[model samples]
Target: MTDHSYEFTRAITRRPGQSITRGLRAVDTGAPDLDLMLAHHADYVATLREAGATVTELPPLEDFPDALFVEDTALCLPEGAVLMRPGAPSRLGEVAHMAPVLRDLYADVRVIEGPGFIEGGDILTTGREVLVGRSARTDAAGVAELATILKDWGRPLREVATPPGVLHFKTDCSLLDGETVLSTERLAASGCFEGYRVILTADGEEAAANAIRFNRFVLMAAGFPATAERLRRAGYEVREIGNSECAKLDGGMSCLSLRL
Candidate 1:
């Protein structure tokens, strides 16, 4: 039988380093508050634990400022894990640092090699199909490599060109459920989600588009009351968590953990 997709029962997260304030961001949202980010990180881990997932916490990488965004380092699959080669050259070390950890937990761990750049945030699997985005962070080479790796899984693949304005495909959209997507208007109009049910976030709540559907509840970014209400109306048990600190560093709920 085919394994259930997005069925993550364990999660791995990292503590924030003092230099986390120097993390990468498209815009100068200003430096993030290390304390607030740490506090928020604790809450994030708590949420995962509350959902019955065993949480593995990694120490802060004092050298990698963006190491807190652990998901970029790898993509956890039912069969194994794909250690990524981050788009930013500076972030490549993250994969190296995470590989050993993954090898300890998974027997079939693989990686994307040179000349191909891929970040976990650019790939979205909805249990039905895999939607890979061609963005600044994930090129055709990267997508092709991923397709090759996923061939054994036998899922339909769609290579969608990410909207120009977004940092990553998921920066503008997220898989809310097997067939439901929460996306920004620009990404929603890209027609990449034509067959799925799309729920657009409220005006100015674009960042709210990035969310994670954990074992039970949906962990959404705080400050988007309208979007939160819309999700609640849809019958999803939504949990709002403050994201202001992570936002300054260009992170969302999805980027904070490697769910497996």
Candidate 2:
């Protein structure tokens, strides 16, 4: 089966700081570094366009300075967009703000209303199946509900555990293609991401493992010398953009934006 063609969009927030998650509160939130982080995010978006994708920038959501919210929380599907009820209570408002923006782009927009919480980052799709990771941010009930919503659309859903200490499944892992995945040694060793061809990275290079593959270009951080070389050697045209500022906030290439 052929994968559905999609485009990605992101809101560039004036507040380009690192995220403070429920688990990790010690994250650095230095102020001066934000400009550099915003620049890197712009570069990443530009790289996507260069790779033949149509990227549109949404107006900056300045009210929410930590606006480069994880792309997964703002779940987007081919038929429409699903505004997630962020697992984190503080982030719930983000979905309400994102709904109108997505509605303008898509003919249909929906919501995963909560008695249960779900984040977009926990959801990943391969055109045929939707994989939902049961993480700190996504509940099992959310997954089951999502599965039911997608059933008639021909998108089967699979649930997997994101495991502890990992931000999200896609934060530590991403599918480069139907058969090829880029992941950190931590996730690969867990034996949870088994059954696929996995490319593991070296220690501390796990941040670079979370990348976005749009068209033929791979969006990754600017500084990972060895890992970038490895991807190039594997025949992918890699785009290394600086996202150090976002990194400081626990954000990576895949977290900052959502592709429709």
Candidate 3:
């Protein structure tokens, strides 16, 4: 099946710095508290470890307000790592910082050098193929470039559309297993996951859609009880982490780490 997307042996996470209070947001909900964010981040990393992953925790990058959202920096696959070209200008330097780290681990690391832009958060690699959403942070050219890269690894890339106003594709969906997906109704309604089993987030608990299925646990943002219970009932080991501060910055479970 060639699927390592959900079952990961390791993960990379960065601590949230004081500058995270100034992180980018679609709407200014409120400023994130560094203390609260750090606490939540710790829980997130610990949960990943508990799920049987060797988590590499990196120090905070104060200069990059959104650096804690490491999932946007690169796509970690069984084949190798693909460094992303973020659409956000301020986030470009983040890739440079992550490059060395990934190079140390992967012998075949590739970069997206282009007039186009793509972020790892916009990508979803299922068992059968890789799906990429063209969102505000990911363009057609970037998707094309990524497709070309994946082709060499004998992977298929399918271009999809991110729901309007979403920060990234994963902000509305996640792979649950080889053939199932947990997604917001709005995104599933788009017919993007046609052949896969789709579990829609409980109505009004849409934010819960941005969850991740790590090795043996489904890590989700705290506060969405309905969605959490829904997943539990569906036979997933659910772990809820405090995400109040990260939520304030439009960040969620999947944004905190890059699993490989």
In order, candidate lDDTs are: 0.86, 0.69, 0.91
- Comparing 1 with 2 on TM-score, the higher-scoring candidate is 1
lDDT of 2 by residue, 76-176 (tens): 77776777877776677777776777888778676787678788777767644677888888998787778777876677888887867776778787767
Model 3 misplaced regions, further than 4 Å: 1-3
Best by TM-score: 3
- lDDT per residue, candidate 1, 38-71, as tens digits? 8888999999999878999999998999998998
Q: Highest lDDT: give the candidate number.
A: 3
List TM-score per model, in order: 0.96, 0.87, 0.98
> Model 1: what TM-score?
0.96
lDDT of 1 at 73: 84
